[model samples]
Target: AAALISGHEDAYDGFICDEQSVPAAPGEFGVALDASLAVWQQKGYRGIWLKMPAAKAHVIGHAVDRGFEFHHAEKEYVMLTRWLPSSENKLPPNASHQVGMGAFVMNERREVLVVQERSGPLRGQGVWKMPTGLVQQGEDISEAAEREVLEETGIRARFDAVLAMRQAHGFAFGKSDMFFVVALKMEAGPQARELCMQEDELVGVRWMGLEEYLAVPFTAARPLFQKIHAAILAYVNGTY
Candidate 1:
């Protein structure tokens, strides 16, 4: 018989399998996994977390056959989960927060970079807001902010400091959202001032005076927007 998989109990009374200890062969892995599951169940373990590296992917089928479900995956590995008891599985869901950022780029002329989104809630509403987008996996908020500014307006900018943050629930797919308002400095180049708006996602991109932007009907109507813009202005004026 194959040796039982090596692992330790988690704080939540769950067993976390050691990836390095997983059997390389499918047949051996199946036998070892079964033995481990039996032992865990006998010990009244609540859940089992199996981390399988890409090299041991062949054994993933064995874990699945034993009722393990995919929890999440990365480029080099996959995480499988199983609840030992028959009662409802209390295993916590994977990553619950979605991060987003808005780029606040201003020039010496007191003009801020703004974009007219071709789609989204503000589309066709004449709302000119700061360039914003969701942060990609493994990307930092500052990086996302600069990237959004560059992508939407074709104006290169360097990350400064995060001026403010807002959190809200009931976002897309029931995930919580973390919105970061980041200050960015426009880079020195001809492209920095030229307009090359992303046609698919933006209808227009331009530099609007701070007061003009803050006066937009949409911006003027929302207190949050009012405060956020005030904060950005304070940061630029060295008063923040």
Candidate 2:
């Protein structure tokens, strides 16, 4: 028997087949795979997703031969999906799946915190972006956002909410990068006291008015800056 999962907010409604769920029998895999797809289709699900441990290549190969397409992968598993009769069958925007976090912090004066990297491709290019970094292994996304802000700008902040998220393939050295821009409230009192730059890594750290930040000319990050500016506007207008 195959395990069918549904009613989950983050996952698509689908069925999963694997060693644990379906015991390995000589020709049982093919029979189970077809039966699961048939049941899901009969139940009116638009798509079916299959996830298997990377070690189960044979099982995954069978599903792939039956039209399951690659979706994404993780350290221990690979995800594959097949669209049902009424499904659109669109692939995810980025399959490489590198996750990153960014901090959009605003002070009480409505000024946005910005940073300039000391080194890397954009160093000294006059393009200022939010405090951002790739999330470390096993790290919480929210914690990663807060940590990145403190590391680059030396300004501690509290995560307010996730304002926006986007994915781009071949970003930052040709790797797929999924970026999350989170809203952070600058901590008050002693915590918010100074503009300390990570000297070795950042060229500058300062707070600028949202409008001023938006109006500044950007080199390669113009699109991203515009998106962040839009997110700020949305927050102010209570749309986000």
Candidate 3:
């Protein structure tokens, strides 16, 4: 720490203290605060940054009470500044939600556009899998899924109906993520792959019949996908 400070004079435009130390308890935070203030004073530092992980809104409010303000970095985390008077970083007025969106893009003959992920933590890469995405801003899950199928597989789709919603919990990228299971009815023409590929995110996209999808094995979430398909079949048959 000494070497970093002395070796590079005026090197940092300003500093971001990702963390000063592990978070202290309710009363102990005052000690950390005093210690941090001392360091800032002695070092001739002009600004301080703090990171509040998770929904520590009470702690954040306390920090604001101590004159810290927060800025949103992304959907997942916030960056806080302690050099200025606090202001509200209230989450915007739009209602936010998370949902699973998926599709069974079947043609008149019942073929579907299936995509296989090429890389990353999930298995079944480069194999047959349904097109899917998470519902985003202004997106209804049903409509979001249709857009996902079209974006991932280049197949214009129409929904049959929602099939199911269930909790899918598993490890990927070294952490557990839960997803909602959703299914929809869809139809596409023979030219399903006529559009450009979202190549960085997908390796291959193709149309396959239910028998073919069932024939080829999937890795994680395979059972979930299979169940969605079965439900879609039932829905299309007027039984579900």
Candidate 4:
């Protein structure tokens, strides 16, 4: 009974092969699996996942011959899966991972904080954006936001809320980066007029009103710029 496999209604789509049901002997294991798959087909289950422990690695060859393919692996186990006859599965391509954090900060005057890079990808392009940087290992995202803002603008600020999250693959060197934008309220640490840009990275740092921020040709075209705009409105309305 596919319906009885789990309480959830979608159980008919797949079944999980139990580790306990794996026979120690190679011959018996194959025999048992052939019969199990036949029954699954008649019961309308579309696929089955087999989880094998590191200790039972010898069974990998037999599992592969029976149509199972590698799905994912962990430190202690490898998971193999197969689709039943007449079923099709669409799997995504493998990808790389990277993550970054940004800060959308505004002072009491409603002017947004922005930075111009001195080096790296957009050097000397005259494009202004919120202070953003890659998240460091063992650093919390919120902490990364605060650190990036102060490091670039020399203006201390406290994180208020997550304004938005945007991501894309193949951003650079065939890697994917997830960028999170956080809203922040300016604190009384550094004055904008005395801005201190980070050496070798930032060339300019200052505050600008929404109209001026969007007026920057490069800044207005960014997808996240619109999200920051809406967030600023919500923040000013006391509803963010």
Candidate 5:
């Protein structure tokens, strides 16, 4: 309400009431909408279209008093839009997923940017894998991906294409992981050239062929990577 009554006029097009967090009392359409619009009009606002349940028309009628008109109605919702002819439409950014985020470190490859971890849970682990990491709070998946890739392997990478999004399942030695199969355009070579191994965490970063990745003993992977590997190869061959 402060946004409507005290902010800049023409600052917004109209307000969208996503949730009726404040349900109106019975017989208060005029009391609610007209009063609200009057406050907004003072700021030079153009119009406001509120999507409320049709069952709440008594509260909507108040808007009609302030030049608000009915635009549409669906199920229990009625959309009332009032024009002040000056207000601009402003929308908030979409909410991010509630679940945690993660990314895949791709290498420039006509093939694959794979690695065999030197340390961690599978110590002396020679399993081929795509570089991936968990996103920390306040950090985007891409940012975390780059940081983790650099920390685990000395490879610097840019996210190319997203190949896969595995929900409901992923692997982790500590935190939960939401692996995004990202692509990195890279030339085939030694992964160690860019290896920034956190000696306590990883041992090696080896770039290898897709077939090699598939053939690495199953003992070197978590269930998530095995599936990711299958998905990746499907792309390598342009099959799936």
Candidate 6:
């Protein structure tokens, strides 16, 4: 016989299994899970959420055999979800927005940091843009901006403030994107003026005059880019 499984009720009248209460043996886990599902159904639970850590991956097959479907996964754990109700399942989807950060780093000489990507939409186009990258999990926007600037141009900078934000739908994999443009002041040191471009991702990294950056063909073509340029200018001029 398997031990009783315990869980808590969720806001949606669902059940969230206590991962710590999972049985050690796969057979015991299967028996406990089946009993829990039957109890939950009798209690009128509409959905069930179960998180299985990588260490307990062997038990995932048991959950699948009981009707749980993969919802999402991270490095340490995987989330499995199941709709218990016979009616239409109304559980919300996983994360839908990808957050990105752009760094507008400028030095005392008023030259802005820019990079020419070796790959991407601007590859081989001679278009220079601010260093940008996706915000990693558990990273702040400002920290991501600083990290991107450092990784792409080898320039250390301090985050000042967010200059602008842009949102759009129909991005990669049918998900939306939220882009943040942030202002950063270059740190004083020999590395500040040195160029050490990331070879694989960038063909060139250099500092260009702010006016020249704003006049680039790529910048002129996009209204949002022009707006971000204006915001950076305002921030530098202390009028932001």
The alpha-carbon lDDT assigned to residue 139 of candidate 5 equals 80
- The C-alpha RMSD of each candidate to the native structure, in angstroms, is 4.1, 7.5, 12.3, 7.7, 12.5, 2.8
Clashes of each: 0, 0, 2, 0, 26, 0
Per-candidate Cα lDDT values, in order, are 0.88, 0.73, 0.59, 0.75, 0.56, 0.88
On TM-score, the stronger of 4 and 5 is 4
Clashes by residue pair, model 4: none
Task: Summarize candidate 3's per-residue lDDT along 125-208 as a digit string, tens digits.
Answer: 456767777777576776787788777767666655667776544444233333444455444455743645678778777777
Q: What's the C-alpha lDDT at position 101 in model 5?
A: 31
Give Cα distance to truth, residue 83, candidate 6, Å: 2.9
Give the residue spans of candidate 5 off by over 4 A.
Answer: 1-111, 169-177, 187-196, 219-226, 238-240
**Model with the higher TM-score, candidate 1 or 2:** 1
Better of 5 and 6 by TM-score: 6
For residue 40, model 1's alpha carbon misses the true position, in angstroms, by 2.9
Candidate 3 lowest-lDDT run of ten = 1-10
Q: In candidate 1, list every pair of residues with a backbone clash.
A: none
List the candidates' TM-scores in order.
0.75, 0.57, 0.53, 0.56, 0.44, 0.84
- The superposed Cα distance between candidate 1 and the true structure at residue 201, in angstroms, equals 1.5
Q: Which candidate number maximizes TM-score?
A: 6
Candidate 4 residue runs with Cα over 4 Å from true position: 1-95, 189-194
Tens-digit lDDT track of model 2 for 129-211 = 77888888788888998888887777888888888888889876577878888888778787664778998888888888877
What tens digits encode model 6's per-residue C-alpha lDDT throughout 186-227?
Answer: 888796757788998999998899889888997878889878
Off by over 4 Å in 6: 1-4, 10-12, 20-30, 55-65, 86-92
Span of ten consecutive residues with least summed lDDT in model 2:
3-12
Query: lDDT of candidate 6?
Result: 0.88
- Residue lDDT tens for model 5, 161-208: 566776653344232345576655443467634555566665555666
lDDT of 5 at 121: 67
lDDT, residue 172, model 2: 62
Give the Å shift of residue 159 in candidate 5: 0.3
Residue 220, candidate 1: alpha-carbon lDDT? 83
